[model samples]
Target chain A: MIPSSWYLILSAVLFTMGVAGFLIKRSLITVFMSIELMLNAVNLSFVTFAHDWHAVKGQIFVFFVMMVAAAEAAVGLAIIIAIFRTRQTLNVDQIDLMKF
Target chain B: MHLALFLIFAAVALAGAANLLLQKHPINAALSLIVVMSSLAVLYLLLGAEFLAIAQIIVYAGAIMVLFTFVIMLLNEGVEEKTHGSRVAKLLGFPAVTVFLALIASIILSSETHLGKVIIGESITTTQDLSAVLFRDLLLPFEITSVLILIAILGAVALARKDEQ
Candidate 1:
């Protein structure tokens, strides 16, 4: 079995990439995807610790996180669709209607 | 064996994440994100979280990404136009994020938290225990998730409907 810390290192790397994507990407949907990637990273870390501690609780937390992510994805995509209809564009720079 | 599996899938997940970030087309980015999620499911399997691995595939890769792709197709917004932010931000930001990752990795690596070195047996028993906890202790949260999903359904329909006045 690999050391649990290795799993954590991988998790951290995935999370950092997610954050960079969130910051550097231009589309609203890509930003949303980045958020999902971040959540996946957290889930991975949780599972790693769950394995390490031999407690099922961390995995349960991952379960709850997944539940919440599903709901968030549904609503977030709907809002994105609404914004697209209103703006006809996916560029985050153009999504500045409330930036005044 | 397990180390090799973890290394392979971890590479897949990271590469897919990078692809998601670099792709100019939202659809391509969404597809890359799906790859990330699927590989994460496999990693979850390697970590002995059986149920969660399946849930990651079904709910995340299957449901959530499909929703993203549907929205992408529905929006039909072609490749994103390049919007150049101020150069200083990029100059300062990329390295800052790299430093942050390095800091986090160092902390995680330096930690001496050793857990059950005893590799557990089949996850079949794990699943049974998980279900017991889910139904007994976690019932409230489980029910709440159903309500959250219901609200999401209502909200999505309300928002995406034609705004006929």
Candidate 2:
């Protein structure tokens, strides 16, 4: 019997890695992937809690989260394409027109 | 057997995440994320979320990753160029994030939250069981998500289309 906390600990670790990638990486696509990683990590936590609580609602929440992630990815990638078209670069630093 | 399998997949997921961070090219990072997503699906299976496990694979690994790869191919993005980032970001960012996450991990481990053990192959949440709660108690949210997906599709097409001007 594996301790549920181990799953949570793993989730935390994965989420941390996602944050690190988000902070360190410069490319927009990779940064977007990092956001997905973080979402996946949270999904793992939701599943773990679902298992422990013997409730289906947690899994239901995971489903909703996945749905939102899909929608976000669709709109977000389109925005990325639009940005790439205008700025002609995927680097975040150079896309600082709004940075003032 | 369960513990061993858990360890193996967990290690694979962690490694894939690290690879996603380390790889400079967007394509390689995207591939690494696929590895992470697949291994996560396996983890979900081990946790007895069968519907979620399959959904994770189909939605994330199958559909989402293909979309990411497609965009990468369309853009023809090259390897990332190393830039001399701000001294604060380069020097303090990694260490700050490392310390913060370490704090969070320690808090989680040390707290008395009482997250019980997960015995594998027991108490599986079946697809029928899920849909019962989903379609009945959560019917409104379910319909709302359909609307959300519709809007997302429209938004994607609108945003990505070439401008007439």
Candidate 3:
């Protein structure tokens, strides 16, 4: 039988990559996607722990996370669209209107 | 048997995520994310989360990603421009991340024995139990989430349209 540690480890690796991408990528959409990737990695860890403990609460938590992610995505992308309309650019570095 | 399946899908998911990071075009990156999400759905199935697996596909891969692509089209932002790579990120960031990965890998591998193996259930019995818990224990949070989604939809509609003076 495969140990649950493997799944957890993979989740860690994915989470780290998401962090790396979030820092390394400049595009707003790519950064946004990295956030989703991070969420998915967390979901994987939750499922791993759930399976190890034989509990359904982990999956239920994953459900809540997905719901929140969906809402975040809708609002986030709409904001991105609005930003692009005004600034005519999608680069987070270039779209720095908040910086003084 | 299951190990091989897990490894294959894990590899695909990892590769797809890597592709998402490296691709220059947002659309290409978005597609790679979809690949990652789909592979993750299969892994969820293997872990006995039958309902979550299907929901992962339907909600994340199906709806969220389509919204991303739609926004991409609506914005019409072309390929990402080259940034003046941050000097701090270059000198310290990449190596720091590598060290972080190594640290996590050692921690996980060293503690492997403490964590128990997942006993795979033969039948798809998770859906019924999941629903039971979700409905009975989590009904309040579930209703609040639906309300959150409604607010999000309204917000998106308001935000995406042309603003009036």
Candidate 4:
């Protein structure tokens, strides 16, 4: 059997990569994609824990997390589109209206 | 057999993540993200979290990735001239990322010391058990969270549209 630790390690690696990407990438779309990666990484760990504990709570929690992710995506995309229209660009450095 | 399969999935995930990082195009990154997400779903399945696996496929690979792709397409944000960070930022970021990764690796290693053997075994792999717990014990938060998500969605749309008027 593949050890549960392997899955957790992989999840951690993936999450770190996602975090690095989110912090380093300048493209708004790329940043959004990185955020998705982070979420998927979390799901991997959650499932791993669910399987280990013999309880279904973690799986159910994953279901709810997925639901929230869907809604977040819909709303996030709309905001991205709106910003794109106003700025005519999606570069992170260029959009500084909200920055003090 | 399971180890071999897990290795394969892990390899695919790494490749997808590399593509996400290396490709300059937003759409390509989004597609790679989907590959990574689907491989994660497979990992979930192998772990006996069938409901979570299906949910990962549907919500992440199906819904979220598609939304990302659509947004990338909608914006027509082609791979414009690649923007480089300032020299100072690049120099600082390299050390910062290295330290961060090191810290995470240490934390993970420390946690491994306390991990006991997996206990659930093969008996807990059914959908019925998951549904029962979800519907019975966690029903309230489940419903409330859905409502909260709905409100967030509406707020996002409203915020995005308000500028048009």
Residue A34's lDDT within candidate 2 is 93
lDDT string, candidate 3, A1-100, tens digits:
6888889988998988888888888789999999999999999999888877778889999989998999999999988888888888888778766766
Largest lDDT belongs to which candidate? 2
i-RMS for every candidate (Å) is 2.0, 1.3, 1.7, 2.5
B-chain TM-score for every candidate: 0.87, 0.93, 0.88, 0.85
Candidate that beats the other on lDDT, 3 or 4, i.e. the better one = 3
Candidate that scores best on TM-score = 2
Candidate 1 CAPRI level: medium
For each candidate in turn, the TM-score is 0.93, 0.96, 0.94, 0.90
Which lDDT value does model 2 have at A65? 92
Deviating ranges (above 4 Å) for candidate 3: B86-90, B122-125
Write candidate 2's Cα lDDT for B38-69 as tens digits.
Answer: 99999999999999999998899888888899
* RMSD value for candidate 4: 2.3
**lDDT rank, highest first?**
2, 3, 1, 4
For candidate 4, give the lDDT of residue B97: 69
Per model, kept true contacts as a fraction are: 0.69, 0.77, 0.77, 0.54
- Which candidate model has the greater DockQ, 1 or 3? 3
State the DockQ, from 0 to 1, for candidate 2.
0.77
Q: Any residue pairs clashing in model 3, and if so which?
A: none
Residue pairs with backbone overlap in model 4:
none
Supply candidate 4's per-residue lDDT for B68: 84
DockQ of 1: 0.67
TM-score of chain A of each: 0.96, 0.97, 0.96, 0.95
